[model samples]
Target: MAYKALYRTYRPKDFNEVAGQEHITKTFRNALKSGKIAHAYLFSGPRGTGKTSIAKIIAKAVNCLKAPTDNPCNNCDVCRGIDDNTISDVIEIDAASNNSVDQVREIRDKVKYLPGVTKYKVYIIDEVHMLSQGAFNALLKTLEEPPKHVIFILATTEPHKIPATIHSRCQRFDFRGISIPEMTKRLDKIIDEEKIQIDSEAIKVIAESAEGGMRDAISLLDQVVSYSEEAVSIEDVHAIKGTVSNEKILVIAKSIAENDTVKSISLLDELIMDGKEPQRLVDNMIAFYRNMLMFKNVNTDDFEQLIYKNEEFQKLALNLSNNLVFYYIEVLNKALHDMRFTTNAKLYMELAIIKMIDKIEKQEIVFEDTLNDLRSEISSLRSEIKTINTQKPLENVVKNKEDVPESKVDTFSKKIINDSETEEPVVNEHLIKAKEVIVSTLYSKDDIEEEVPNTVEVENKILSSDLTEDNNVKSEEKDIFNTSLQEEKKVDNIVKYKTFDIRFVEDVLNNGDRELKIDMIKKWYDLDRFATVDDKPYTKMITEGRIVAANSKLIIIEYESAAVCNRLMKKDFKEKMKSLINKFYNSNLDYLALPKSVWEEKSQEFIKKWRNGDKDIKLTPIKNSELIEIEEIDDEIEDMTPDSVKEAINIFGSDNVKVKRGEN
Candidate 1:
């Protein structure tokens, strides 16, 4: 071959050659040594973690002529043939392309026979998730109960996509991505063997960028080394990879922290203009801030710090507040990730820049507010100090005076225990001193230690009084309800009518509501309130969007016309809206109040009201009236005590009747 990719050239040939998958490697070795191998095995994890390579190793180990060890002696013809795919016994199947029921049936038929020349027939299926439902079903029984001499090794990146029925039958081993340090060590050894000149920084950059994929890092290193005979520098690596420079990232963060709007915008434009994806640009900025936060609070002495390899980047992190950095990191991380799914990407990018400007603007918080915040922090600190100072029992001993005579207090009797046991004096000196401190600190010398009355009974009395007040309120409501019911009965006898109120309006607000509704309907009908002179409403407070939130005191409605809003404040539209709402929701008792203008935008009008003279008239339109004919109404009535009694029975039905069998 003219040339081979470094990753393929250095493909792991033995268990020892594989990097950073000890969990997978150890299991394979044990399986080989124990000879208790399953007929079908599944290896699943992130891509390039050696799942495919391990499957190949298994194929070779089982078919090796001279050995049963985990490591295959590749010098033998069997191992050589397996590597070359010339061995009749071993078959490597790319499941992704051949995942069909027919293909699976063919394989199932073949696994029934013994190996041609080798000890066992091995079948390796890669990316097995692509197998159809029917294909997996076909493979299920054969895979579960394969011939003793046949081995099935299925590998997939997303094991979750594979049918659970087939997955349950196979011996599953999850391969993991290689750790960075492990990948780095292996890359360094290969660089040495290839005699490639590269700096440690370049190697580190490639390793971290690989994101735990060893083969990826190797491939990256090979690409970087192809064009350079000199040792690679961070700058060179950054140029080739089109990665954000750590210094530039720091400058952007600093500008954001300093509230330098001009610089922040300039930097963003430069990045976007220079081919950085707006989303990726946001991502890098987020990572920059996250690193600053990690450095700000954590003891990095114990951590393997990877992001800011440059000393200058570390200094920038040092200058930023950890809390502020953390806040920015969290917001931008979410924003950057969300930006991918957004339709207006430029708008989202503008939003991210605006956020950075906001952070910078907030850096200089008010001193008084910060002082109040520090009080909480100080309390937390004192609590920590208290916890650390005395883990011993009995922390509180005395508070008043410095000394006490134990002889005068001999009536008190107790013995204290300590983890440190020692002989006590006839009277403990410490207790005497502590007692003296308590007397002076807590009480006056002449103050009597009387048997004071407890306040529990007094509290109970107040509580009972409050409860009685609640009872009175409830009773008042009951009385009102009863009175209302009696009034309702009278109203029922005297008239057929509807009851509603229109209120909670100052005269000014009522005037505003009247004007607002007229203006709204004008817009709804596209008519001019003053005159039909324009396409738009005169009061541009035309309906735009719903009122997102409202309350008893105020209702804030959205409008297309900012000018209308400005005029409303000058003319008190809020008061108007409030009165209108009260009138519609609780109708003005006189029925003179107008219905509220600010109904939920999506809700159809439930009630409509119009002002009649000085009194408002509310109309609840009957959509479909079902009027009863007089004869039909009479037929439903029963025989009664007279025309009046019969009418009452007919009106109230059997419910108002106390009639015995023949009383009527």
Candidate 2:
């Protein structure tokens, strides 16, 4: 006799044999006995949760040699034939492969016939939601009003796709995923029966790796059994799955906490050398950090109730500071997000780990930032990298300065002034030699200029050049200037300012347009601040960045860690940040990849503000459809001339203005 896989050999034969879905099982078993069955039964649930198995159980119980037992007797001729697919009455179809109106019409044609050996004919359609609209429409009426001899059992992982017309006709029985404990217990039984020597930690890993899918767990169990016939351990399973070990994850976390980039990166390399997948490393480490965090703060009365089953890790969580653990978890989570779109998973993970190390080290001497802060900082660091990447070096300084103004202090005018009398730029000893171009360009023309003795005369000539523009030119400029001034005067006196509230954390990460976490943070904090040109707001931080842990009232503006960064900004910053963030949800925000408890330590400021009815107003949640993008703010502030300031005050009000009030 040939060997059968554990999942196949131990497949549930009766409704009672199926695990973790008693609701659906009990409903179906009673339906079989009561003779109140619907013509079409829609079974929906997550994968590996037993929708298909229950369908088979119903098929056998109804067509059993004996008229009515909730449980089928496997030895009976009808049961054995159907179980082996030898019975013509029980037809199990894979709708995924045969999903067409034509295929459904064939079924519609066949329902008129009677059962051959069994009492009733049954059609089991697996992945029924995969069917096209036409296919579903074809089977609608018969599904609602099929003959007494025919039964249709439709199963799918996603029920939302099934047409409402088709869904209304069927009796819906939803199958739920088996819980971790129930899955673990079932796996333990298989291990005992198969005589496979494995430890408890190893069993737990298989269950978690299955992600609530029983079929997946059993299948993995079968594979693990084949990997090593010797005494099996959790470490062996880790090696097989390319998963990182708890010890390695701890070392990396400690390095991050210590701010040791070199050591953290070295450990990352070692894991890669061990054939570990960067994706898996990031995933396992995230779980490890999450569990450690839960252990530190929450009372998970049964520590075993949480995911990881390693005692060493549980013990390690006890010794670590609450802040450090969350920081590393946040770092690894960013790494995992990067892994999804990147083909070079190892490269991205390594880069993410390195970024985290840098942030941790940067914040080492810093204070107050806890584990949550560390996570936020890691995100900022990634944003900074993107900013550096996108900046362009200037090439032609002489050409760029062709548009310079002429005056005592370089003022713009109606005419282009070539007056060269800008008081030599008041160069200081600390400053390097002035060139033709300095601030924006790589080179400057100031280095080649000849000195003049009568500077006041030069200034007068330049002013004359600007003021003496042709009458036609001056007239046009005067009209335009007055209109702008009028608009500014109207804007500066307004009282109310707009603010936005992020209803939930999920909205915070999803920008409708582009994947931009960092830029969103910077813009939210202050409209005056520009995201680093490389990729400030979104790419570097949230898309695949790290958050930092810092100490102080100042959020120490960085590229990543928008969550905390936004919180640290002024109340106005929070509103502005929320508004900017509203654009980031679709890959128009998708690429933009990018929380916490303070044991509720309240501030008196919030109370005072609340009394004034400031805090009582509900926050305006973002709309689902406004577009977002990883874009540079195109405001005129960067080129903030005197006129720009006057306009800003008019539009935003005096309260929104932050000028360097000079003391003359």
Candidate 3:
């Protein structure tokens, strides 16, 4: 005889012989004995759980030499012939291969004929859900009203794919996966009957590796027997399956509990070197941790009931908290899922172990201790600031009294008089330096003139000449004055006629309408105007700041200096700004504040873009034309004037400026 595989050689020939499906087998036997045979039958369940075997057994029982028998006697010629696939009356079809409409139509053509040898003709279709829609429709009519002599048995692992019409027309039996214990009992029987030398532990391992499939368990047993010359041991099973031993898994778990990342990673590497699958290693680790968690939580009496009842597990559970166990399980489960798609499975497994170690270390550092340290640092900072505040005014008063030049006395007196209504006087450092320079120049003017005799002689000659040509000199002076006046008027006209290009205005309006933009700007300005620090308004910090541009969710404000921009960038200030916008507008908006120089540069870029006629332009006509007239006179003056004049403007307002030529 040729060699036959274990699963095929030990195939069930009778309903009673099938393992771990007593619910279905018992019902079938009763149905057979009662002779309540249906024209069509459906058997559905997980793979290798006896759906096909039971289907074959039902065929045999129905066409037995002795009619309507619950158990087919394998001794009978009819049963033997059907079992050997030599019977013409019994047909076994693999629906996966012959799942087409034409094939079903062939079956429909044959159902009308009577049995050739047996009492009844039986057709067993395995994997019936593989049938095409057309094939299913073709079979529907035959299945609903089959001949009295024809019996159809449809078997599938996935019955949900079968149409509801077919399901309703047949007698359905659902089979379940064999339990571990049931599978083990059957393996023990098979081992004894086949005279196989395998220990109980080896049998248990094979049973678990099969995942409740008896055929798989028996096949694994056969492989182990073939691999081992003598008695099959647990080591043989583990080697055949490429699974890590419980002892190795326990060691890994212990290393993880001790937070020894190096040892855990080394053990994992050794297992992979020994040909243990990376995914299997992760699965074992998850199971090991799950067992430990169970041991930690379950009653002591139930410890033996667990699959991993060992001392190492108990010791590890003692060291682990519930939270750590949960985190470990979560990491391993995620790694297991990731292993399927990852090309470098070993690296992923190693990373998951490292993460577990990191989590454990983090849990050891209490949050309260960190918070207390931070509070202490903040308190020390406050004390230092308070000391500095107490001494700053006195130092300032002494410095002011000592540094005041005689020439600056009148200017300081005027400032004091002008600022009487202010709560606190703000001293300008740059102004004091300017006043000192002016006094030094006044004291050295005569010496400078003595040193530059040629320049003085030239001026004297020009003055004498101008005295003689009085009319010409007067007309020249008038021309110079008029030129200055015209320049001033031009500056005023430029300020009054300031306008933004249409493209730039369109970009702003693209974000939102003009009314909405103005409203947002007003709300933001109010927020800044009312913001205070220590009962003093923050408005002082941004004295010359104003919103330069507005869009739906973006508002650009220009500040006088980078110092104010930096202040606004602080986290506390930003949070306050966001809070006010969200509170009043009921919307979140992004704000940007730039120094005057940066704003001018950006505005120039916008104008350049407008000039280029970029295709991205999408313009909305402004309802209020005046809104496009940006009040950018200050920016224009700053850009057009010389650096010295700009600096003077910075020290004093543009409105308080005068220009005069001195007499020789």
Candidate 4:
């Protein structure tokens, strides 16, 4: 007599009526037909996938008046009573609410009794994974060897939470999400039966929004129908869901692809003014780009799979390269992620759009290409060095300095011979050219001033003196020159340690020793007082930060603010901190500074690598003495039952490890 919601009113009555999941339904029918029903059944999958519905159907089929029938006779009194909840033989339990050892023990105690006025007794426990550990233990024995007349059906959205022991005893059926097409077809039938007027586009909008859940689709349809007294339109669905229209999304994507920053920002402002959420807009843009990418790659004629038609997708995809499209997707995805923690979502979205346009414009000057060029130059230099080693000795030319006229030698070589009186050596032409290239390519003017010195004069002095002297002096010059060259190499290595970014963090996390890193962090924290300059405690300024990762040579520290980072970036402060760190470790180590936000991003990236089973990103085990001591204390406290001991362990990590004893 009362009006019911569409999902409830159209609940599937049998296996044939259930939408999707025919694999599970067909198996149930076959098992029922052959009279080989399983004692315990576990249905697990995403929500609204018919796990509970299939459980109810199986119950009716087994308890139907017609013995061992695949289809339940709904017209029969036995089926009618079960459907009305009047039959005592069938019981439905919500394990989420009654998830306790006592409740499970009650079920185990009652499972031995035979069904009354029915062929079999069925117990359906929904959200069974919510049951406590003790409750699962209680259910385990009964589930393993249930009475012949009793049938247990356990259903959950997350099967991974269920213990393997329970899983081993049950026949598990995984229900999959309903497809969009399947959902659309079902909605069409429902509209036709209900005599409701709705546009096909509106049905599609609801179906896509449902995200592969029939119940959700039906509920959305019902809500939209209530909102529009007449035929429902796509606009109504969009307004109800607070989503931007596909046409607006297309326009935004087109603006980005065309590098129209002004147009993109203006349209974004309009959307924000019109109550469109910034995060939602970002998500829609990401989806639009993803669909364009699919159209570019997948040669499918099915327009249903795409959000836009083929022609529209073609026009957009043609204007964008696959690499650019991927880059846009990554930018939008990052914006979407940042929107969650950011207070000004609209500002972030606007900046994201600007960045996309900037990236597209600068796509010609890719960083990867720059790195490749650097690599090529380095290889060329290596080859040049090898060539120099095989060439005729310059010593012979210098040995005949007296035979050649003054004008014969070049001014550059004459200057080297004249400058030999000074302690500085004249660096050879090859080494000078190499130094120029390194400075030009890798360092700025200020860095070059600090890096390469007047070593050329020093080299020239050694060569000139050695060519005009005895064997002992020549040998001494050779050793002195070799020492100077080694020092230059060390300076080059130091230049390579500039500053770290996300890539460096990733590298350290993947390849750096974990225990050594933890040890370094602990030592840095302990030696904080010594890291000070000009009476300002650099350590205190950096104490708010943390060392997230480290290697033998480099330690990555993350600070909460730019001020702290800037303070630590001071030359004197950095030197003092580095000195302190070296003192503790007894080895030269460098500290890399990063913002907290950047650290969080890199940490998430590293975690994803770990999850994907990346061999390079191995998670380092925590084996520091401090942690070991805490663990030992925990083991000792396990046997203590006093409330004081429990509270102490909970607060101080151990019952016996106290900051202070009682005064008495």
- How many residue pairs collide in each prediction? 15, 59, 0, 12
Where does candidate 2 have its weakest 10-residue lDDT segment? Answer: 592-601
Q: For every model shown, what is its TM-score relative to the native structure?
A: 0.58, 0.56, 0.56, 0.57
How do the candidates rank by lDDT, highest first?
4, 3, 2, 1
Question: Model 3 — which ten-residue stretch has the worst lDDT?
Answer: 421-430
Candidate 2 segments exceeding 4 Å error: 296-312, 315-327, 340-343, 359-664
**Best-fitting candidate, scored by lDDT:** 4
Model 2 TM-score, 2 decimals: 0.56
Q: Write the per-residue lDDT of candidate 2 for residues 428-532, one digit (tens) a residue.
A: 101112221222122123412321212223433444443434546545655666677788778855533222223222222111112133344444433323444
* Superior candidate under TM-score, 1 versus 3: 1
Angstrom error at residue 608, model 1: 50
- TM-score, cand. 1: 0.58
Model 3 steric clash pairs: none
For residues 149-197, could you state the per-residue lDDT of candidate 1 as single tens digits?
9999999988889988987898998878887778888998898899888
